[model samples]
Target: MANLQESNHQENWENLSQKTNDSLIRVRKVLTLSRIILIVFLVLLVFLFLPWRQTIPGRGTVTALRPQDRPQTVQNQIGGRIERWYVSEGQEVKKGDTILLISEISQPYFDPELPQRLQEQLQAKQSSEAAARQKMRATEAQMSALDRGLNYQLISAENKVKQSINYVKSDSADLEAVRQFYKISQQRLERYEQGYKDGLFSLTDIETRRLNVQNDNAKLIAQENKLNTSRQSLLNAQIELDNIRVKYQESVAKAQSDMGTAISGQATAQGDIAKLRNEIANIDFRLGLYVVRAPQDGYVIKTLKAGIGENIKEGESVATLQPKEPLVAAEIYVDAMDVPLIGDRSEVRLQFEGWPSVQFSGWPSVAVGTFAGRVFSIDRVSSPNGSYRVLVKQMVPVPAADEPWPVQLRQGSGVYGRVILNSVPIWYEIWRQLNGFPPSLEREPKGDGEKAK
Candidate 1:
């Protein structure tokens, strides 16, 4: 019984000792965790409470590769097989340089027979206009002649009327003189007859006086008739003069109307000629569609892969022209969080993966030194890669009169960029005050540096 009790006591003591050691180990681990927690809390407190640099900060520089501005690509609204290439790939070109010629069917004139027909029509109109002018001139001349003749005739008729009036006056005077003679003769004859009858005069004397009286009466009657006829003739002459004057005016009015008609005809002819000329010019413009020239001076990136006699639809792209003057820029992506911090006038440092540490100093790096400039654009939308894109422009260096940037840089070169953001806002500093935690921390549980059991 004693041995049994001793053994039981010993087992109890071993169990108690094991429990004490475990308690010690647990205390040591608790202290170590407390110290670690204290250290982390101190670090976080320093960061959250620390004062930082301050200013109205603004600057973001992206690692800039040799940036290339997009090349100018020549496109066509009307497409056809390339008839001829005026320039070869990588050839230097200027503004308004003719690059390629496309062919469909070129019509120099709108109408199939327009040139000849227009020529004939123009000739006809010219001849007609000339004739109209000539006719107008002739009519005017005739009108002038008629006006002069009418004036002469009017004057002549007036003179004739005046002469007839004088004739009438002279006839009236003769008639009056005849009547006076007749009256005197009649009185003498009567006296003679009475004397003869009363035997105071001879019979022969009375007969002779009677004969004189009859002859004088006949002369007076004839003179009166002539005077009446002369008055009637004067009236007729005046009527003729008035009628001639009216007819002359009518002639002049008719001539003026004819001249107006000729002028109208000539104007109509001119309008027709202008219309035809416009049609021909339109045809020329249409024919120009068969020729495709570079829209701007650029490199030919995509060439026409069409064979001879290949059909191309209208507005189809036959080739892409990357403008030589404006270099193509690498489109670099940026993160969203970095975007707002990137202020305007952000500088970018670019490094080409293909070429690095090369001499890109001064303005010697780009062609058309004037076209090369600084970053001017940033993409408003994010890419699928969750980043924003921006365009970096290089200051183009003036070529050394002999060397250029290989007919301007080609398109789609991979580039690396580092955006430099300067003077981070007080907001970011305030975020530092929040222990680098997102503003949504209140909505989520704190990690407390441990896993949940």
Candidate 2:
């Protein structure tokens, strides 16, 4: 029974070995077929998509990141020991936001005690102006009084002349009356003397007549002399009045003119003082060398090798500012051979090595990729090694960040970019030659449609 069992076991083992061998052979064949299929597939993919196929003509492209158009921030205008900071590092600021305060120290045009001195000077000027105004008023009052006095003096002189003339006229009239009375009395006395001599002897009546004739002769002589003296007095008074009136009118006119001149001089002085005050104020504002402000609602970048107590020279860059919108711009050098291919308004295709399959192209980006943008400009001169440099603007929204703009524009972010030259036609050289001008092509006269070079 043991021998029979051994025989059955050997046969079973033989059958099992055959089945195992057949299975191994089939597996080998399947593995060889699979290898062939994989090779064929790989070869097909290479032929269809390899760059060497020359489906499109392109130069080796240089990659770079887009740069910001505006600078990170404007430097401070004033240089001094920062007295006080009005804002924190990352603070949102408006157009006219005050970023910091500098202590009012002595500047080029500043005195140590300028503020106090200015105040004192202003007060003194105020007092001086007031005093000057008061003096002007007093002078005007005096001038007015003088003018009035001169007029009165002239009037008095005229009145005196008039009185003198009236006296002269009365004297003349009295003289005339006295002469007439004397003549009439003499005629009557003569007649009476003749009648007395021819008639009877009346001694008392003759005596009375003689006394009247003597009195009339004396009165006439006195009246004539008084009239001559009164006429001389009237002439002297009229001459004095004429001279006094001329001098008074001249003095009054001069006084009035002088008052006006004084008032004009005071006004000019006031205007000059005001202009000087304004200039001083302007100088005060321009006293500092630098002005610092918040940069785009962001934190101050304090990475500079400077300290608060350090003395900074003029035009020295103290600190860099970080803007809210951070971008990573890579500057790459392109060869001269490739420069002409890349120009303004070209489309660039970008590939991220980190995200192998991800790409960026065109104005509107697709699939979490940045868009292509026009070239901002190209350096007129090439690099020292004859490599050309071109600056391009990238159409990409800034990546979202919790930090603000000032903090985001930090130095050294890694980015890659490609500059798009153009989608050149297959017959680019021929097309350029045909469309070129001057010796190559010219516009046809009227009635002609299209012309070629």
Candidate 3:
């Protein structure tokens, strides 16, 4: 019995030793696995804090900053056949310079005698006016002469009246003398008759005295009649002078009226001539419209229709002119997925098509052959190409020596740009992508000083 118990205890001790060795091996394996997993977790944690830049890439074309101002279209102002082109494509021009000449199609078909007839009519009117003026002058001169003659006639008539008055006075004086003589002769005859009766004189002497008295009486009567006729003549002369003055005034008034009519006719003719001349001037102005002139100073970017003899309608586009001092801009189309990542005034890096350098936009310091720019606008709607439009303007262009890029970039050149977004770690990017969530910032990114760490 003692030998059996001792055997069982020895067996229990061997089993316990085996169990201990198995437990030690299992613990060793667990420690080795734990150390490996801890190392891997530490490495992943380190990667999560590493700084990385997020960028959205887009394609664009370089264009003028105000694209609407460029590519101006020149249109024809009138409909006609182009006679000649004074300027060619890509030519620079100044304001008011003649650019082309157009010819009216209906010019040759119009009546050639129209202008000549107008001119002839104008000349005829002018001549008629001249003749009317001459007639007016002649009439005025005749009026002046008539006025002078009338004045002289009036003076002469007045003098004739004075002479007639003097003649009447002289006749009255003679009549009085004759009457006194007849009275004396008659008295002497009567006394002789009385003496004869008293035997102092003969019959023949008395008869002679009577005859003398009768003759004296006849002379007195004749003198009285003559005096009356002279007075009547004076009255007639005064009436004739008054009539002459009235006639002179009437004649002068008639002459003045005729001269006024002539002057009026001359004025009408002159007005007609002026109107015809104005019409001719208007025709000349209309003819001047065949020449086309530049409205502003610019360069002709292209000619839509420059061939001679081509007919163009009014207001049709003839050419395009690009104004000087055009501004530059980048018209980019960003992917819809990346549109939310950009905003106004966001930093951008551009790479021109012909430039030979690689650009790592996430790490801009490692980039070459790229120009710096900023986002100026973000479209609220998608473009026709199923992408959002973003407008970018270049900062002060760096010199080619400073950055291996062109100092002057042409308009309409192809370009590629990257819109710099928030800075994050590569692990976060992987996590967000795996979760199917849009990119976002965990916290506000630090400045350059913190990012360098």
Candidate 4:
């Protein structure tokens, strides 16, 4: 009995008992239990000094690694009525596989031969544009011909002007000579008449001199008329030269105006052709939209616009598709306080929904049925729930202890994730937890430390 109570304080509890051995032996177990508790506490305090891995736990969803690999909506690019369904929910389809058929719901795409008609319109406009171009070429040729003719006529007119100037100069010289002769004749006649009056010469000589003067006067008058004619000819030649230029300008201007008109017509036709071609292309694209096809290899999840003849608006979802064979990931959300402690290469332990797992959040090495992963992405901003999102990708060359993820692991399934961080003393972890502090990083993670440096 004493052996059982040996660890207890003998003076305190034993003295309180009677000196009777029977009462002492049958004493309460209060001091024994207190001693046991104290010993256990001491052992616990020593254990708290041991090293422990820090971790942050979060809830998340199972999803694809890439956004394109994720489940997505199948939509129609144009408004239409569901005519037929080529696929049903849960059916597998390949990329470009037709899922449903839709008929035109709007008035614009009603005509079955609409694209052909547009093509015909485009063809006609193209023909008109061609004709306009040909007319423009004809006008240009006409302008060139007019220019050539103007060059020839201008050269001829210039030569005529030079000839007229030369003729005027010759006529002026002849007129001056005639005036000198008339002057000499007049002086001779005056001298003869005076001698005849003074009886120095016979009346016959005076009469002959007077006749010579009249003759010289007549010649002078003719020469003056000739000079005037030459000047008039020069003036007429200049006027003709100007007329040629004006006439050529008129012809060239008419040609230029015609060419401009043809160009305007060609431009208008080309614009119309472009409009028709654009319409054709758009209609072709819209025609393709009538057959709703799967954008990727996937399974049809659900029909968004159900039933035949149901009207759907442009860009409306027709069905949902879950892509096949996606690279799956665990996406978890952690509190803002804990996000800073996460590292890009942080190890992740995932508990996928519908899968059995025995997890120790603080110690992931002994965990069972939980797959391993590493940080792949993390959102800079908080989620709607005020938690930061972190994406964890599957670990490559997986640990021999970890089993492969189940093939049946589907997207949007629930996941519980634990992001393993740096190791620290258990006491520090306890103190941190007690103080609501973030996980400790006794040493920064390899990747994070390098980044910090």
Q: What overall lDDT goes with each candidate model?
A: 0.65, 0.56, 0.82, 0.89
How many Å off is the CA of 378 in candidate 4? 2.0
Q: How large is the C-alpha RMSD of every model relative to the true structure?
A: 11.9, 15.2, 12.0, 7.2
lDDT (10s digit) by residue, model 1, range 5-102:
99999999999999999999999999999999999988887665543332121122323243233443566656566666676656766557776676
List runs of model 4 lying over 4 Å from the truth.
1-42, 444-453
What tens digits encode model 4's per-residue C-alpha lDDT throughout 201-279?
9978988998899999999999999999999999999999999999998998999999999999999999999899889
Task: In angstroms, give how far residue 254 of model 2 lies from its true place.
Answer: 7.7
Cα error, residue 239 of model 1, in Å, equals: 2.8
Measured with C-alpha atoms, the lDDT of residue 296 in candidate 1 is 62
Where is the poorest 10-residue window by lDDT in model 4? 19-28
| Model 1 error, position 287 (Å) | 5.4
Candidate 2 TM-score, true structure as reference: 0.45
Which stretch of 10 consecutive residues in model 3 shows the poorest summed lDDT?
A: 398-407
Candidate number with the higher TM-score (1 or 2)? 1
lDDT by residue (1-453, candidate 3, tens digit) is 999999999999999999999999999999999999999999989978876677788898877777554567877766789999988888999877888898876654256566677788899999999999998999989898997898799889989999999999999999989989999998999899999999999999999998999999899989999999999999999999999988988998888899999999999999999998987775577467788877678788888896789999988888888766566788889889888778777778888888876888457657876777888888899998899989888655543334423546667789999887777777877777699776574435467637533
- Candidate topping lDDT: 4
Q: Where is model 3 more than 4 Å wrong at Cα?
A: 1-48, 106-289, 294-298, 396-408, 433-436, 441-453
List, residue by residue over 31-96, the lDDT tens digit for candidate 2. Answer: 999999999988876644422100111222223343332235445554556555555544455444
Off by over 4 Å in 1: 1-36, 49-100, 104-124, 165-228, 272-289, 303-305, 310-317, 327-453
